[model samples]
Target: MLIEQSPSLPTVAVVGLGKIGLTLAAVFANNGYRVFGADINKGVVKTINQGKSHIRNEPGLDHLILTAQTNKTLSATTSTSEAVARADIIVVIVPVLVDDQNNIDYQFIDGAVQNIANGLKKGSLVIFETTLPPGDTKNRFGRRIEEISGLRLGRDFHLAYSPERVYSNRILQDLKNYPKVVGGLDKRSLELASNFYKQAIGCELIEVSSLETAEFSKVAECVYRDVNIALANELAQFAEKKDVNMSEVIVASNSQPYSHLHSPGIGVGGHCIPIYPYFFINKGLNQGLTPLSRKINDNMAEYAISKIERGIESFVDKNILILGLSYRENVKEPTKSTALLLIEQLRNKKANLFVNDPQFTESEITKYGVKPISLNDKAVSTIDVVILQAFHQEYSKIDFSQFSNCKFVLDGRNKLNKDEISQLGIKYEGIGL
Candidate 1:
């Protein structure tokens, strides 16, 4: 049941006002709780205080922000400590990233902990919503909170871990719909967290035994996807050699109640899938599937570029325009996007590379060391190859004839209409098809 606004509802302090963080704040504010969002970005804070959303292309976010602001139940702040001091519950969604060597970097989480600890009071519940390696939630954060705040774990303050399970464009809906898995440092922390989310989220809550379980469950879920995608990628390559359509095969195989196979793509990129496997693999476990899958998925970028290379004679000065800049379809986030890896390979080959995405500005695309080219621009006539890295809806009805000199279209994602491209006198090839 949606609770009505009441003064008794605990105030929520949401640290990190990124897209997911901000959306969560708005939802909590609407759900009968006072919400204060904290971010280091002053501009984002100012935009929220003015009752406007700085995030674009997300459905209904602007109106939600407006409603929250109008009610004066939500506010923004530049200090995490400032926000934490006024709240009974503090939710930290600060990101924990992996570096190039696949080593976990806790800088952002460490900084957030420092600030949160400074203002953390006794008897408040602290829940971390970021996905971490198995025991880092307790070892990296829980102990640090105790040291800094001078509070006892179960008696003075509460600590728990709950992974964020929402997607980029569907955060609000997923939060209400998805099963929320939560674990705590102890039974006291678990009970308090379960009670808080039971009302704040109003979603079905699954309580586990320990913080490590909640943390591992999230990474395990992501690792499962990475492993399956690697299998699909390998199968896609074999299908390409055997002249079989992997997509059709997958459709047929998935018809069974027991078989579930993921799609094959040029690369797997996102905050979750590509990075989380390392959180498990780096535990120094001697696992075969996990490490091999990581290798296969990471190599997919080079494999895709190799396919394009075999199609053309030389990439020394060829005009190759990449169709999408984002790693995924329709979302503006480019974190660890496969398109970046492809660009690096093509750059080494010295191809004249260009990119276009409907979600990003020209300046944004150019920052990646590639010129931005639009399908409508007259310069499209000079391109030789078109690779569909991301299957954004805007590219569905693309006019192939516009690329007058284009010789091949490589559907890195199996999203393009091959029959239409071939009928238009262009050589069309999709992965595993």
Candidate 2:
């Protein structure tokens, strides 16, 4: 049941106004809680205070902000101290990214902890929503916050790890649909954290024994997808070699109800899937554990890159037109996206590249130093190679006839229907087809 009458809801200090942060803040504020958002970016804070949105991907966010501004239930601040001064609950939703060597770089999380610790008051509940390797909560968040604030855990203050599960472009829906997993330093911390989320969202909160377990659970879920996708990609390659349709084979196998297989794509892209497996692998190597998952995911990128290289080689003097540049369809976040890697490989080969995406503008695409080409532009017809890097709805609408001059269509996403492209007299190469 949605709690519409929470006059005693706790005051929330949401530090980090990014995509995940803003969605969380809006959800709490909309449910009759006093929410304060803090971010280093003053412009984003100002935009929110004015009932405007800084990020476009979050749905119904502007309305939430407008209501917050009108009701005076939500406010923005640049001062961490000011943000945390009166809050009963503090939520940290910042990114804990991995380095090139697959090491967990905790600099971002460390800075956030310092800011929160410096301003924490006794009895404040700190919730770490960022996904990290196990042992981060008790060793890093719990110890650091309590020690720095001179507070006692489970008494003077509380700490918990509840991983964020919202998917980009579908955060609002997923937040309610997905069951939340939470773990804390102690039982008291877990109870407090569970009660807090219980008021705002209708999802079940499964409390675990320790914060480390909670952190590991989130990473494990992501790594599972990474490894499975890697397997699917490998099978896609094998199918291509055997001239068998992998998609049909998957469908036939799935008929048994026990065999479930994911779709095969050119490469895996997304902030979570590509990055989380590395944390498991790197930490295991440090402690002497098997890095089977990491090896598969790392090789997946290389394998997908090889396919693109082979596709490029099939055509001479190829002027490749990349259909999608953003990491995934309908999202503007391209971090760790395979298209960037493919672009780098192509640039080294000196292949002329033209990139276009509906979510980003010419200025955004040009930041990569590649020439920006639009699907509506006549140049779409003149390319020698067209790779469907992203299956954006906008790109799917474009008539393949526009690419009449193209020699080959590399459907990395298996996006184009084979009969449609084949009837157009264009040679098509799709992964797993």
Candidate 3:
């Protein structure tokens, strides 16, 4: 039911209430749209209805969700079919993954589409916010919905593709700041979807010619990052052999307007960077560059390990502490964390291991079969080598030189103060320094 004072806005159903989806639900509700969040997790639904935020990392999201629940604008349910039946607009943002062989797995997305099609109301607009292959939005999902829901395309229902572009910790701000990229099955679908997003998100709407363009644009964004990061990594590796600091070179080269170089790291992780390139590769695009870039980024963990082993005398019993576990700093989700890859390589060398991440509890860290110790603990001082993986803010508060017996600190992110660590008479090594 629509509220009397806010009857002008259409109701919204945000499916797959995970990181991006939950924030989308809260923001839409705060914007005076009655929103129903659909998730299979009953515990998550229960927590949201109680005016609590399931994800604690997103700034201002707790308050946004609380205000929405207090104003009775938002609630959640486990039934996707029921949510779609009640709303005028449906948004899908589930996970799409690649298997070990780099094959696209549509299990989660296919499930969401099936449920959405079951109770899809006539005249309702459907928008997909997941990252998919260039044609999956129109050919796979749009066609499947038309078949299952028995709704004629462009006549009985509308469909659009608007890939979720928000970062993990900056969803609310990105939602209002970034332009919403949208494309549709037809002209009318494009117009309706574009107008709704303009008011609902309170942001500029960037419309494309078709759904394929929108899908391809998102994949291209990830590919750009992946390819550039690979280039940076290649340069850093070469600079390491030549005794030249790649970090300083990056700073100098990126000064001009034409040059925009990314920082090299141990590895590229997260849902998008590591996974999206496979979508095009699976499509059999006769492109060697994308595949080669993916290979370079994927091999970085092994490269990082080799760098550590080159300096360290032995790894048989040396206590090695890896800082941070999540894919990125200050975020809890660890879909394809570089730390996991580093750990695998370290384990092969028979190094005694310990791990720490502020986002995870001590018990949680132990689940990975490693001891968890704090910076102040005596055991931390005995660590032979320290590897900075995620660069969480908590690591910033500690003194790096205080590790009494430490041989060197390998800063994978190159974010540490090189001067300070070196001035303190403690050895510091960045990716190429």
Candidate 4:
């Protein structure tokens, strides 16, 4: 029940060593804070403690890990108790996913809260940085933690919600650029947690009145992107019917200087945009919330998959290559990614699927009971169709000579230049153009 004040920096424990958690740990460690990261995965713990990286995203993860190791200021463990008991501040970043039925799943977050309750000490601050349904962190996690630990809020312990606004590929850059939003159960809770993030991120820390406001802000940001993307998706479909290039149309519209249009793609992927719209739609149903945004984004996936299928109708047994598997380019996370949905839909049609991603290895793909072909393999000849799912840099630099044997190309990302592809003598089609 005692809190220790270290001379160097406050000791912090970051629970759930996923993409966000590990990145935050390294950032904090780089800033001279003593950090202990805990994860259920033993391999992740070993990699961090041994000064190696488990995931690839940030450029200086290895350098940060080495710094943490040399200073003996950062370590990781498989034991959640050891992590919680040793720290004065705890940050939680876990996934809260949605099912096909539009139900929110909180098994991961709930289990993490239970662990925090078991080991949380008096005078320690606990911040929930994961995006969740509005008021769930304040009413659900706060109440449960208090009951189990017998610690009163604002007296013995503190709890707050600080939703992370980090982009997938630009985590390090956004850490300094994006403002941190925090809301808490009480005033003291807000100050304690906001100060911690302000120090590590070195950005503006915005405080809202309550925890639900912070949660709503996070969901609202993603929903805004979803709605705008859906507008582009809908416009793309109409533009195709009119025989107009959607990309050129959007570019022309932007000349007005008042119009900002998002690009259309195979579909909206990633954990945020695809999932957050439902949280708002379902929760605000009685308030007359019509989720036109969620409907459009969800349908775009099926539409793109259907285009791929229709493009190869002449081929009996098809060999299809998906260019990228990760949600977006330059990131390793594939959580709730649209590529899996597209892959599953293609499998149901009994088509031969060949997957290729530079980020993932053959062993990782084998874990899913499916092996993807290497993009570098010259033997991968005579592909019936190729879907450019992710616009990775490697895919951009690919020589047209290698894909000469391919019959058609479906540009889901609209990554290729329209005029240049027509000169290549291959049939190329994109989402809008």
Question: What's the CA error at residue 91 for candidate 4, in Å?
Answer: 1.0
Q: Give the TM-score of candidate 2.
A: 0.93
lDDT by residue for model 3 (1-433), tens: 2222246667999999898999999888988688988999999999998999889789999998999988988889898999898899999988999987889999988998999999898999999999999999878998899999999888999999998888988888898888899999999999989988877788988999999999999999999999999999999999989999998898999999898889999888889999999989889864787999999998988888777787886688888999988888999977788988888888888998899898999998888777888888877779888889998998777786667788877888988887877776667888877
Task: Quantify how close model 4 is to the true structure by its C-alpha RMSD in Å.
Answer: 2.8
TM-score of each: 0.97, 0.93, 0.95, 0.92
Selected candidate, larger lDDT, 1 vs 2: 1
lDDT of each: 0.88, 0.80, 0.88, 0.80
| CA deviation > 4 Å runs, candidate 1 | 1-8
lDDT of 2 by residue, 8-55 (tens): 756899888898898888889888688888888889888888877788
Q: Name the candidate that leads on TM-score.
A: 1
Worst 10 residues of 4 by lDDT: 1-10
lDDT (C-alpha) at residue 302 in model 1? 88
lDDT of 1 by residue, 366-389 (tens): 999999988889999999999899
Ranking by lDDT: 1, 3, 4, 2
